[model samples]
Target: MRSLTESDIRTSFVNCSKGEAQRLSVPRDLGQLPWADLDFLGWRDPGAPDRSCLVAEWRGGLLGVTLRFPPSRRGLRHRSMCSLCLTTHPGGGVSLMTARKAGAAGREGNSVGLYLCTDLACSLYVRGRKVPESGGRLEESLTLDQQIARTTGHLSAFLDKLYA
Candidate 1:
């Protein structure tokens, strides 16, 4: 991953219109990001609780997506796993985030969703830099590189769907 500017983030979006991308909130901490540790950069929009964003480098180019987290009724009763980083979150830490499909399909109201970390901190979780706050267990036997690969693959699959 590389440090990105607000323009880089906005221009990288494949699923939204230029005007929409320009208006959406980009993370305020672009300069402070630990790029070496991120498979992708993701953040929640502070003004709109349901809005989130993710951007990654893929196939020699950058691709970004804007996501929406519908308010959940389950809250903390059940546990869910992030489809990308494969981290397990107890309670309601895992959110079902959806991005509108790229191009015309998106304009027609189509979307794609995945269960992911509520705060979009999958990269940190996978790197062992951050831990789930619930004092729960994440008993994965895979090595660090393997875990990173798996998470990247999952996100790639989602991007593939958007491009398809």
Candidate 2:
């Protein structure tokens, strides 16, 4: 994935009003991100723990989505797999994130949800740069590049649903 600028990210959002996109926070350390290794960029909002953002190179350009999740339930710990990267996590590490559907459907309160890494670090986990809190990723016969492709494919499918 190519490195993105703040303006690029803010303008790429398809599901939110321009004002909301402008108000959303972009990562402060964009310059330090591992762009070459990323299939997409995702992060949780530091100021608003329930809010998260994701940006990816889709079709010919960038696509951004805003996501929300309920507050974590304290003392709940169980293993769950992230649908995007297939990494398993315990407790609050995985969240059921919901993104408002694009345009009119979103205005009608329609949304799409998926189990995802609470930290929004699927790219890092798939590449072995970050480890899950519980057991590691399942052993796979596919090569590292193949694993990366599978992860990206999952993400693309989810994005496709947004436009459906």
* Candidate 2: tens digits of C-alpha lDDT, residues 53-131: 9999998999999999998773546677899898888888889999999989989999999999999889898889988
> Clashes in candidate 2: how many?
0
Clash count, one per candidate: 0, 0
Off by over 4 Å in 2: 74-77
Model 2 TM-score? Answer: 0.96
Query: Over all chains combined, what TM-score does candidate 1 have?
Result: 0.94
Best of the candidates, lDDT: 2
Candidates' C-alpha lDDT: 0.87, 0.90
lDDT of 1 by residue, 45-101 (tens): 887889988999998999989999888777565788889887788777888988999
Which candidate number would show the highest TM-score if scored against the true structure? 2
